[model samples]
Each structure stands twice: as C-alpha cells, then as structure tokens.
Target: MSKKSTEQKPEVATVALVQSAQEEEDTITIPVMDIFRQMKKYFLPWVLIAVIAAGAVFGGAMLLSNSKATPLTAMVGFTYDGIEKGLDPNGNEFDANTLKSPSIIESTLTDLGMDTKKTDAIRSAITISGVVPDDTIDELTAYKSIFESTNSVDAAQKLMDVSYYPTRFEIQFAYGNSEMNRSQAADFLNTMLSNYKTYFMRTYGYNDALGDALTAVDYTTYDYPQALDVFSSTLNSLQNYVSTLSQNDNTRFRSSETGYTFADLNESINTLRSVDYATLSSYVLGKNVTKDKASLAIYYQYRIDNLNRNLSSANEKLATIADSIKNYQKDSMVVMAGADATSSSALTQPSEAYDDLISQKTDAQSSVSSYQQQIADYQSRLDKLNSSAVASKKDQEKVETDMKTVCDKLNKLIDDVNATADDYFETASYANSYSVLVPASGSVSNAVSNAVSNMMRPLLIAEALLFVCYLVFAIVRAFIVSYRRNAIATAAVEAEERKEAAEAAEKTEETEE
Candidate 1:
C-alpha cells in the first residue's frame, strides 16, 4: 500500500564455505592391538594390580563360604495340607544361607519332569531347617495335624513333583531309612505318634485313684437282707424284755397314785431315739460305707424293730387299764368295795390280784408311751435315710460318669502322643510323649519367620560388599586416569624444553658465523 516511496534497502551477502574438518579422514586405521598397547603403556600395570587384589578378595570369599560351618544333624521336616496348592521342596541343601519359599519350591519342581497335578495324592514329608520361612514352617506344623487326622503310606506318596533345594526329597524311604518304601515311612511316623500318646496319658493325663474309688469293689460277702432281719428280731427281744420289766411295777413297789406323766415318758423315748440314730450315722454308717453296707443295714433294721417291740409292750399295758375303766360300772364298784381287806379268803385274793394288775397296768402304760415315741423318732430317721440314699445313688452315678469322661480324654491324649512320636519325633529319640522342637515360638511362629527373614540381610550385606568394591574400583580408575594425564603433560613440557635448548644452541652458532 506504500508504493509512493519505493526505495530498495542494500542487501549484504554473507558466504559460508563448507569444507572437511579432518584431513586424514580416509587414512589407514590403527589396529585394536595398537590401541590396547597404548592403554597398557599408561594404565595396564595399575589395572593389573587392582585385578590381582580383587582376585585375592574373591578367593577369600570362596574359602569362607566353603570352610565356614559344620554339617548339623538336627533332623528337620515339613509338610502342608488345606493349601490352595502344594509345595515341591528342593533337595539341594538346608542351611542358614537361603529362605524356603513355596513359590521357589514349586518352580524348582516344575523344572524337573514331575507333574504338579498328582501332588494331592501322596503324603510328602519334607526334612528342612529352622532357617526356612514361616509359610514353609507352616507346612511342617500341618504335618502333625494331618498325620494325626488321616495318615498312611499311600498318603505319603501322593506328591509327584519335588523341589528339594531347601529340604531333603524323600519317597521310597527316609534318609535314616527305617522303612524300605514310602508306605513304611508313613507307617513308622504314625506308629511313633501312637506310642507317644500312651506315654502322655501316663505322664499327666488322669487321676487313677479317683477313678478307682468310683468303680469300687464289694468288700464283704455277707447276706445283707437276712442279717438285717436277724438283727431286728434280736433287738425286738431286748425291747420286749425291757417292756415286760416295766409292766412288773408290782416288784418295784410303786404306789398306784404316784406315776410319771406321758410327757416325761415321751421325752425319754425321744432321747433314746436321738442317741441311737446319731450313734448309727456317725459310727455304724461311717464304718460300713466302704467296708460293710450289709452290716450297716442290719444295725439300722434292729434299731427300728427295738422301737416297735417296746411300743407294743407299752401299748398292751395301756390297753388293759383302758379296758378296766371302760367296763367299770356302779355294780362293779359296789362289789369291789364289799371285798374285805383280809376276811373272805377268795375275795381277798381276788382284790389283791386286782391291785397288782392295776399297778402293773400303770407301769406298762408308761412304758408303752415311751416306746411309741421312740418308734415315731426311729421312723422319721428312716425316712430321712431313705431320701439321703436316693441322693447318694445319684452322686455315685455322676462319679462314674466323670471317671469315664476322663478315661476317654486320656485315651485320646495317648493316641495323640503316639502319633507325634511316629509322625514327627522319633528321630529325636525323645521319651514317648508330645515332643516338638518348640520354635523360638513354634512352627509358623512369628519369631521363627522373623529369623528366616533375617537371611535376606546377609545377602544384602554381600551385595553391599560387592558395591563397596565397585566404588573403590571407580575411585581407583579416576585416580589412574588423572595421574596418566598429568604424566603426559609433564613429558610434553620436557620435550618443549629440549627443543628450545637446541634452537638456542643453533642461533648461537649462526650469530658466530
């Protein structure tokens, strides 16, 4: 749009000429040997020294790795069940060098010609070390439970693949070779556990004495019921004699009017019953409870019979008096009064007899009352005893049940101990009991796992040592390169000094000419 001022600006041209920078671009090349020679001239000797030192370090490491430890004979084993998959233990070695990983185990076994599909069929007992991981230890712990639950030789041979790098691989027989076949290995393990169970039962399982008491044996062979009956009869005779004596108040010369009340007779009867029952329960029952139940029963029956007989005699006397009073009429009173004291011989004798009968009747009545009270007390005790006997029977039954329960538990414990010995602990030669190489914790124990994890630390330390060596090499290489550059600079400076000296001499000669 601004065509009015068509002034052209001068353009200055700048030319850039491109040319080859290297003059000997196509010159003959030096051979690799020449380059190496040049490097040797500057750095080979020091590099060689470093290499020799490195070789010495490597040799020392190898010696330590080989001559570091003794072969430990502590027997170790592991197995697993209820896992999503099975572990194939590598039979290379068991030591503190590496961890026992299930994945590693499976991979190692797969490298072999074994198929994992048949792993579930056999029981594979793996002998391993305590340095193994918790997951691996878990398998060992499971061995005990599985062996105890369902164990056999067929079960032991189910595994088709085995990775025994960490654990010793076994199929036909164990390392010790107690059995010639896989079946025998399993059988041996199972039997050891069973024997261990018996040992445990005897060691701390049950109270033998308590069991024996509950299942008590009979002490005496006497006839219980017959003896009781005879005792009752004898007691009855004694009671009857006592009653007869009481009825003979005529011999006692007692006055007809002066007599004890029924209350007094009842108290004496009550005292007799209390004393007898107390004595029986304390002495007779205690003495016979474990020794002679038959004798105790007899004694009890006799006490009851004695009470009955005494009551009967007392009642007979009271009845006679009652009958006399009931039959007494106005005419009978007049006839009794008409009888002179010592006149008509027949009438006097009859009066005397009547007086004697009245006295005897009073005494007999008192005795009858005492006996009746005693009988009542004896009956009450019998009722109490019968109730107690019922409760005692129930207690006996409970005791027997408890004994049986304990026995069953003991048997099961024994079985478990035996299985432990057979399946896992025979090699230890321990007492036939539950013997476990109790982990810092136990199988699959956290401490054990932590210890296994510690294996990685040593590996890390080895790597660190290698890294330090690399660092030292790098530092030495840098120092070497710098020293070579300084040496070359010093040589070039000396050559320049020599050339200047020569030129100075030539100039001096030219000046002279």
Candidate 2:
C-alpha cells in the first residue's frame, strides 16, 4: 500500500506540473480586446497631452517669429536686350551688381528725400541674381560637349573662357534692417530703379562730349582763319558722328519729337560741309583776312614748320607699314585630296594681325595727306602775309559780317543736330535696351503664408511625436496591469492545487491505514 501511494504521488506531481505549464502559457498570451480597452481608457488623457504639446509648439514658433523683425521683401526684374553678350547698348560690359552701387543708392536717397545714411543699409538689403532658365544648364552642357568633341584647342579654350549672363535678373530688397515699411520700401526701390535708368541712358545711350565741346567753343577769340578752321573742324566732327549714326541698321528711324531721321541729319551735314563750309573757307582764305597780320604770319610759319615735321614722321610710318604689308604672310589651310576635292588645295586668308596692319597703313596715309594739305595752306597764308597787300577797314568789316553770319548758321545747325540726336537716342536707339520688365512689388501675402507654414510645420511635428509617445505609454501601462492580474490569479491557482494535493495525500494515508 505504501509503494502504491508513492507511485500515485508521482502521477499527482506530473499533473500539477502540467497544470502550472498551461496556466503560464495562458498568462503570457495577450488578447487584442485588452489592448483596445486600455487604449480607449487612455484616449482622453492622450488627447489632452497632444493638444498641450501642439499649443506649446505653435505658440513658441509664433513668439519666436514675431520677436524677430520680419523682412519686407520686394522684387524687380530687368530685361536687357544686350545681356546675351554681357554688353550694354554702348558696348560696355554689363554688370547686374551695379544696380546696388553706392552712387546709385545715394542718388536714389537724394531723389526720394530719404536719409543718405541708409545708403549702406539699402545696398546691403539689395540682392541681385540672374533668372536663369531651366534649360540653360542643359544648353550649356550641350554646347560644351559639341565644342569638346571637335578636338580644337582654341575652341575649347574659348568655350572655357565663355561666361553667360541672363537677360532677366531678379532684384530683391530685404527691408528688415532698412527701417522701411513695405510701402516705403517698394517706393524706394522703384525710385532707385528709375534713377538708374536715367543714369544708364546718360552714360551709355549717347555721347555728349562732342556736343558739349562744340557748344563751349567761343569763336570770337580766334582770328578769321582760325575761326574758319574751327568751323571746319566742327563740321568734320558733326559729319563723322552723323555718318556713324547713318551706318546703323536703323538709320531710317525718324525721331518723333524732332521729326528728323539719321539720313536727314547726314544730308544736312553734307550740305553744310559742301556749301556753307566751302563758301566761308573761300571768302576767308581768298581775302587773306587777319586780325593782326604780323602775329598771324608768325603763327602760320610755326604751323608750317610743325606740319612739315608731322608730315615727315607720317611718311616714314607709312613706308614702314607698306613694307610690313608686302612682307606679311597670310595664314593658310591646306586641304588634302578627297573624293569631291581636287588633288590638293590651299586656302589663304588675312589674319587679324595682317588686317590690323592694313588698317593702320590706310590711316597713316590719310594722316600724311592731311598734313601735306595743311602745310600747303599755311605756306600760302605766309606768302600772302609777306605780300604788301593790306586789307582796308571795309574788307575787314565785310569779313567780320560774313564770319558772324556763317557762325550763326553753324550754331543753328549744331543745335538742330543735338536735338535730333538726343531725340533719336532716347526714343529709338536705347529705348528697349534696359527696361523694368517687372516693377518692384511687395510680398506681403507670400510672407504671411510662409510664416503660417513655418508655425504649422513645427506644430505638426510635435503633435505627431506626442501621439507616438502616448501610444507607447498606453501600451506599456496596459501590459503592466495585465501582468499583475495574471500573476495574482496564477498564485491563487498554485495555492489551490497544493491544498487539493494535501487533502488527497491525507485520504490516501487513511486508505492505507
């Protein structure tokens, strides 16, 4: 009986071990229902924490943004026709950064009656960048590839040296530190740009040096021959200027204000040179008119000597240039025989150096001819001075009258030409070269949108983080609660099993007795 009891105890122990293993497996397995209940229970607290976090993030962002001075921005665009070649209409290199030059800023402040002390601030606030197109890089890359594939070292070098500039440029004015309101900043930028346009026109549109020189000349200080020389020089300058204008592709363009074309100006200049100039020159030189014959004779001799020296120098230069031209070898390219080509052929062309030499030679010959003519005129004048022919008071008076009349006509012609040229340049020549394609405009709406977006971005991120943290806390809390309850139920089951085992052992001992 004791032996049977020991075997039964082993079976009872096995059963208890199996029951404990089952209880542990049941305790470790978690149910989806408990998780859902815990989440629901913590939903209100999670929402409260999330709302607080979102509020803090948004308020902080707003406060930080508001504490800093928000920049008032304005944009302006430039449309320069000559931007492709990086040149202005006057063949000067174009620089977009010059838009914010100190000179321009100072002028703007002066024009706007603003404080000139803000010049540096305004310059600092101003930023310029080219509005490069999306395809510009691709185009540049393709160009570089094609040139590189050609295997031409010079072409490759030139390509490497090439710089690109955009026709459209963006001008940004950040006015946070400039102490300017949005409206004021916009006005200042627009005024500054307007002043720049005026400056650009004066600097590059048309040259006023010749006009100013002609206007400043006081012909009364010169004798009759010298006065004739002045008129001749002025006419020659005017003819050359008009000739350059006439050579432009838009030579037929007529000025709306002056009602004159370049062709008309050229015609007027030619007529004056041929008719008025010839008449005055003939009258002055033929009469051998002079304010003081002794002084004039001495001047003529000096001029003759100077001119002879210049003529000799010019002749020597001309001879040297002629020899260079005769001995200069032109660059040539040899083409080997091909299916469509002749046996072999060589093509020759004048290099830039050769062409430059030819041009210099032509100019030297022209200078020599001019010097010879001047020397002859001065010698003739000296000869006339040597003669005992003294002009009477009547001849002098007549000469003076003709001189005044011709001077008046020349002055009038100069005035007309100035007016026409000014009108032509302002209205036609440079009218479209540099322009404000887009005027300065404020970005108030965009600024507001950006501020809102900035605030919302941080707020959303904080809220998302809060949500994840709340979920993890809720899940951990749920697991802790579930574990505690399972541990207590497990302990109770083990106690009950021990109690039952004790009772069974007592019954078995009694049965054995």
Candidate 3:
C-alpha cells in the first residue's frame, strides 16, 4: 500500500470508531435536562389545551346550573312557650326530629291533600333546625351589620345566610311551586303542633273539657282572669247550688241539741219566772247565733233555774245523811262510855235513814253528771258540723271560680277557631301557648340564589376531569417524543457503523490487491 492511503485509512478507522463509541455513550447518558428541554416545546400547547378544556367545562357547568329548575323555599319557626321548660323537655323534644316524624309528616300530607309518594322527595328537600335564641339572634344581627358594611346590602340577611346545625325546631320547605310550598309549610307546622298538644294532654292527665279549656288560659299573665270577671253571676250561682246541696244532705248538715225535755223545761221556766227579766235578756244576748231573742232569753233562764234546782236537791240529801251519821256516832259513843245501853232496833233505824239519804244523793249526783256530759257531747258535735259546712262552702266557691275562668278561655279559643275556619280545631275547646314565630315565604331572589349554590359541585368535577385529561396527554406525548428521538439516534449510529465497516473492507481489499 502507498503511505498516503495507509495514513488516510487509519485516520478514517479511528474516526469511525470514535463516532460509534460516542453514539453508544450518548444513548446511555441522555440527562434529565435533555428530556425537559424536549418537553419544554410542548408546555405552552398543553397549557393552552388544558385551559380551553377547563374553560369549556366551567362554562357548561354554569349554564346548566343557571338553567336548571329552582325549588321554592319556605321557612318557619315554632314557639315552644307551652313546653313547660326550655327547648329540650323530658321524653318530648318536639324539635326537628319530632316535626319530621313519619306520623306527623303523613298527617300533614293528608290534611293538605298531597300524595304519599312525594314523602321521600319532600323529606330530602325539607330542612328543620332548632330555634335560635334571642342572644344568638342579636349576635347574628351584629354580624349582619358588619357584613352589610363590607358586602352587598342584599347579602346581609338575618336567617338565610346562617349555617344550619339542627339546632331549632325551625322548618324549611323546598320541594314545590311557590304557592304550594308556602301553604304546605304552614299546614305542616299546624299539624305538628296539634300532635304535640294531644301528646301533652295525654301525658299530663288533662282528660276533661275543663282541663282542656284551662290549657288555653295564658299562664304568662292574668288575661284570662280579667276575661273571666264577666261570668261572676254564673260562678256565684254554681256556688249557691253547691251550698244548697250541702245543707240538704244529712251527713253534712247537723243542728245543736238543746237537752231540755218538755216537762222539765216547763217546770224550770215557771221557776225562772222568779228571776228578773233584765238578767235573762243579758244572758241570752251574749249567746252566738241567738234566735228568737225573747224565746232564747226564756230558755237561758230555764237552764239556770234547772241547774239551781239540781244543786239544791243534792245538797239537801247530803245534809240529811250527815245528820243521820252524826246521830249514830253520838249514840255509839254514849253506849261505849257506859251511859245507857242502846237497843239494836234504835241503831238499825238511824243506820237505815243514813243509808237511804246516801243512796238518794248518789243518784242525784250521777244524774247531774250524765246531763252535763250530754250537753258537752252535743256542743262538740255542733262545732264539727259548722266547721265542715264552712269548708264545703269555701271549696264550692273555689271550684266555681275556676270553672268560670276555664269557660271564658274556652269561649275565646272557640271564637278564634271559628274566625279562622279551622275545621280540625273546631272540636277543641282550647289551645296551648304555642305560636308560629316565622311564617313560610320565599324571598324574590331565592330561586336564583339556590340555583347558583347548587352549581359549585358540578363545576369542580368538570375541572378535575379536564385536569386529568391534560396530565395524561402531556405524559403520553412526552414518552412518544422521547421514544422517537432514541429511535432516530439508534438508526444514525447503525448507519455510521455500516459505513465504517464498508470503508474498512474496501481499504483491506485495496491493500490485498
């Protein structure tokens, strides 16, 4: 071979080997920076496509949200003044749970002529909360003031903006046309209250008409008392009738017994004629409930005379017995002193006289004691009878007064029912202290506000889907670009290798030639 050819061939081989080695090394050493550099070209296009997709999704979501049907919104609150205590009562919460019970809902639907199949929908749409306290209301009002200063006047509402937490027995209806929603909300509240009242009556043992009537009397004040004053005559008549009944009944009524027999009274009266008339009159005047002044005075005189006669008779018999005993003792002493011996018959006569007088005195004293006891027993019975009569009369008067108050309240409640033309409550004699604090009615912009509020979820979902699609496209496009680059580099390396081998073979053939 010539020196020029030899030098050129070695230089070409070395150059080919270096090129092949460089290609192999480049395939193994493609850095992250290079990959990023390649992907950089697609960044703007991918972002643009993603932005377009997100915009389309957001626009569609807004259109759907605005175009969808808006349900009517109705709001109301129940006042629990008649619930005995604060909101949570024993066994009867009467809050959101009670109002939303199946029985109450069914009853309300029946009364309003709504179908049963609409129950689940109605329930889903309806929202019930507890009553906000006055303090909470004040706080909310302050917040509203602040909100008004910082935001639009239309956004600063008292109740609509507050977060619901199932706090109060406030009901919100949102399932029908405006008119139906409003009417049904009111009807549902009334029915729930009716059910609660029935339960209250049954639990408290208020089973009678009077009990029912008294329930309507406002315990908060004496409005019923003043109203009841008009029925004073009726109340008085009832008391008088009760009094008459007491007087007629033998078990209740009793009169004092005068123990004077006819004959004894006649004899005593004759004996009392000797007493001065002034004394008799004075004695009779001191008596409580003295009837027939002259006759009572004569009776008092008779009593005094009869007692004196009994005293005199008892004293005389005592004196006679004492005399007989004294005489017998004197004779016994004489005989014992050895003066003259008395016969047994003489002693017997004195002893017999003493015995007879002693027996008579005992009989007289016993008769007096028995008569005094009879008079005392009669007085005790009379006092008891009078006390019972007074108590019965007082009880009757109290009951009559209470009935008057209840009747007045019942009449007032009945008038209210009639005025309202409430057929359900027509048979009821009274109502409790419950009332509707807030009636159901939708604001002018409520429908639009609700539709807007419902659109946020769909918008977020669409954006998420668009984001995923963009990411997937970007990752897949990046991989494809990398694969194509690597394939092209490999093909270039193979072509270089083939060219170098061909050059080497031609050079060797020339050398061999």
User: Model 3: C-alpha RMSD to truth?
Assistant: 28.9
Q: How many clashes show up per model?
A: 34, 0, 5
The lDDT values for all models are: 0.40, 0.77, 0.48
lDDT of 1 by residue, 393-476 (tens): 444344334334433433333333233322222222222323223211112243234333443455456556765665555555
Total colliding residue pairs, candidate 3 = 5
The residue-by-residue lDDT of candidate 3 on 118-139, one tens digit each, is: 5665566667665567876786
**In what order do the candidates fall by TM-score, top score first?**
2, 3, 1
lDDT of 2 at 60: 70
Candidate 2: list runs displaced more than 4 Å. Answer: 1-82, 115-163, 166-180, 332-350, 388-405, 408-412, 442-513
Tens-digit per-residue lDDT, 1-513, candidate 2: 766866578577868778877877866566466677788998998889888887777667656644564544434444446668777666688778877889999998898888999898789888888777777766667668878788777667756665567777778787767877766777888888777777776676456787778877877899888888788899888888877877873558777766878788778878877887788777767777778888888888889999999999999999999999999999999878989776898899759999999999999999999999989888887887688566777877888787777777777777777777767666777666667777665466644554676778787777888878877777787788888887798788778777877887787677767
Task: Output the better candidate (1/3) by lDDT.
Answer: 3
Question: When superposed on Cα atoms, how far off is each prediction in RMSD?
Answer: 34.6, 6.2, 28.9
Residue pairs that clash (backbone atoms under 3 angstroms), model 3: 129-168, 130-167, 130-168, 130-169, 131-168
Which regions of candidate 3 are displaced past 4 Å?
1-87, 90-174, 177-453
